[model samples]
Target: MAPVTAVTEATRSWDPYERGCPSRDLLDRIGDKWSILVLGELAQHGTARFTQLRKRLEGVSEKMLTQTLRALERDGLVLRTVHAEVPVRVEYELTALGQTLREPLKVLTQWSMRHTTDVLAARERFDGRAGAV
Candidate 1:
């Protein structure tokens, strides 16, 4: 007979710095620009239709929005619902798991907003130096 063992957080290994870590894949998914924007919209609005998402996320093409939604759904971060109506409406919302990410994403968004001026100034300085060289 084999002895039974339990897995705990201490026993679990997930290093994003490692080459083949699963956490790296998850980071790639959520770190994408489209994913961040889409998640931000769903976090703010709760539930939104395809068109509503498209409208809110300016410059996002239909294909990109569809791909982002499908990816989020596959990752279990978002829920997709299809309503049986004359027009067959579809809507998306954040799942409980996805809601857990809201605060972190919100903090990142705030940081970006707060640092835009500094970032732009840095970029301008770099470009000016590059032009002289």
Candidate 2:
């Protein structure tokens, strides 16, 4: 196994378009549906419990939600807090870095809401043309 090397500012590449760039992985993390939704929810509502997230996200399974939360927490985008109580309460909130994503994600969400019908029409047109050929 190769020894791990520290990436300094001078050595780091910021271009996500470049293959093998670390930013590509970061893009992949933030670009996913569940991650975007989770981040948006956290940004909107502040802190939320596991069940609250699951209920809001709808169609997300228990396992998928758990995995998504873990990944977000691991990436330092989400902070998980466990309350010391008989029921063992847990909650998640966006970190400062994660908070920065709110605007961009909100833009994307608004674009989707605004253009969904247009996108569906385009898909239909493409499919119709393809069927004729």
**In model 2, which runs have C-alpha deviations exceeding 4 angstroms?**
1-7
Kindly report which residue pairs in candidate 1 clash with one another: none
Q: Which ten residues in a row have the lowest lDDT in candidate 1?
A: 4-13
Kindly list the per-residue Cα lDDT of model 1 for residues 1-133, writing each as its tens digit.
9998887877887899988888898999999999999999999989999999999999999999999999999999999999999899999999999999999999999999999999999999999999999
Error of 2 at 6 (Å): 13
* Per-residue accuracy of model 2 over 1-133 as CA lDDT, tens digit each: 9999999988876998878888889999999999999999999999999999999999999998999899999999999999999899999999998999999999999999999999999999999999999
Q: Which regions in candidate 1 have their CA more than 4 angstroms from the true location?
A: 1-11
lDDT of each: 0.97, 0.95
Give the count of colliding residue pairs in each prediction. 0, 0
